[model samples]
Target: MTIPPIVRQVVVGASASDAYAAWTRQIGTWWPLQRHSVYKQDTSVAFVDDQIVETSSTGETATWGTVISAEPPSSLTFTWHPGHGAERASTVTVDFVPIGADRTLVRLTHTGWEVFAEPLDAREEYRGGWVGVLANLRAALPPSSGGAEDVWLILEAAPGLAATGSVFAHPLFAEHLVFIDKLKADGVLVAAGPLPDEPGHGQTIIRVPASEAAGYIDAAHDDPAVAGDLLVLRVRPWHVMVPGV
Candidate 1:
């Protein structure tokens, strides 16, 4: 009774290096710790000093796994055990394969289910869990694009007077949403989200020809939150770069 390894794959809209960096370096910013963590509280997880560590707001830390081997922009292998001890650790390997100049097919393989008391049940559980984990990864990375040739703009929004906890209830919040909706309707919006680590900060990506990007910047300033000083926003040019660049 040998259990097959659980394999999951997702295509990201970034170069191999960018995808690898997001998965390894920026994991703490995208991982859904609220739904999948050893602790019930909203903790942050990151790869630190060759180990995957999770830290809570109270400063308590948990060692989830150790890095076995890492090849930047290529593959990473690590042990997997969050709430469990090293004796129960499994093995997870992630491979980043470039499908194009700016697209990568990331494949994650989880093995060693035999270590569990009920290997079949554990495998089934992780099968569903990995789907959500990968979905987060997909959302974290930039959306798929043509290649390095494509141009994208990042609209960075930082809290101003609305930095407090009641930002959602702020009167200008509704107008801010309308601004976002207009971008979507114009078909320039790519993706948008609040920063996980930075409270009251957000970013939205829009695809635009380089020639027209300047015009979009002026349009984005019309956002009610920005105009009202509730939020500050700035546009930055972004493009996929090769590994060396």
Candidate 2:
């Protein structure tokens, strides 16, 4: 079979808001420039300034694109034309769809490929280009809390820590209450809660930086529930949600 000159509708995962951010706000942070340009030495696909239209060695290259359709986390379309100055260039459309918790579906499509001679070549090149470009998008997503931050630890725990748990009735568990409350106040505790079970055995996630995690972990050892040998096996990790720790 012959590959068509134009490739249409490339999709990937992300949120509606993030989808918009990916192209408008977050484009430069992730779009890989190493794979683009007539000489593969251009810097136009994406960059830091968020306003870097296109740049070449002297004056041999130029990029033209404006986001025509943008709904954020849903769809984004733009016109792409660079260097060589063909009579015409292709139009690219990208969409970001929500898949599930913390995931987005990203799709990309390019039209006007017929404007180029070897449409098959264009498709093949884009197949690989999309691979790298999308990979860059995956890397650009922000950490939890709807933005980037330091270490984020997602925690899960049982009911003994809840206000209505079996042990919660025991006033002697004051230490647990004291420490839990303090962590919550310090902002080091991203989130916490008793289990959702009737008996209240649930989990909580805490997002904090390594520099601040020690304080919380150290204090956890003092909880009456922990000290009393009731709560066991608290798993811990200094997590990196955005990589490049």
Candidate 3:
């Protein structure tokens, strides 16, 4: 007897792009690795180089799956075989649908149960597991604060503990780059770079819902460079009288 795939859906309080980014790039921050990971303790998980990899604090690593397809703010499909080999892999697909200005419906479908020795039992176990997983994901996203007005913010960053020339070589720089990637994934990053002739002066531009500006500012504060004192950031609203005209 063939077993049907598991399907689950949840509504998240975020735009489609933000919801997708949280499910993908920000997964490590929300996934309950303490109980669900291969090591089950001090483990971190992420999608890196087209594979879902889990790493233990002690340097041990496990491959959960290989990404099959990824369309930002729409759908993502990947193989699944945590703590097992590729021969026993299944498939998981997640779709994001916008339902409102600040809301998205996320659907997850798990399939390929026929590959398991006991497809029925496996499906039952995962059906229950996905509930907790999706719940955790939904809770991690910001709550809906409906507003259509947008505001552009400029971030002026100056060197702190790290010298201007050495800032790029600092370990915190890697984390900063990851933060920038998250911004881009969330469709908020407009542009970022240093001034053409002004040494040690850099700026970043982001557009976000006016009411949620505080949340984005808090996110920027969490950036490694800012949090680690490698860089100091000052955010201010930008009035675009003539944008790219």
What is the TM-score of each predicted model, taking all chains together? Answer: 0.59, 0.46, 0.59
Q: For model 1, what is the C-alpha lDDT against the true structure?
A: 0.76
List the candidate numbers ranked by lDDT, top first.
3, 1, 2
Best by lDDT: 3
Per-model lDDT: 0.76, 0.51, 0.78
lDDT of 2 by residue, 1-245 (tens): 32222222212234567666767765645767665554456454443232225555565435555556656557767666655453666777776544334544455666676766876566557655665666566556632333233445443344322234465565645666676677788766656666545453444456654344433443554556654434421433433546532
Supply the TM-score for candidate 2.
0.46
Pairs that collide, model 3: none
Best by TM-score: 1
- Tell me how many clashing residue pairs each candidate has: 0, 25, 0
Badly placed stretches (over 4 Å) of model 3 are: 145-245
lDDT-superior candidate, 2 or 3:
3
lDDT of 2 at 128: 57
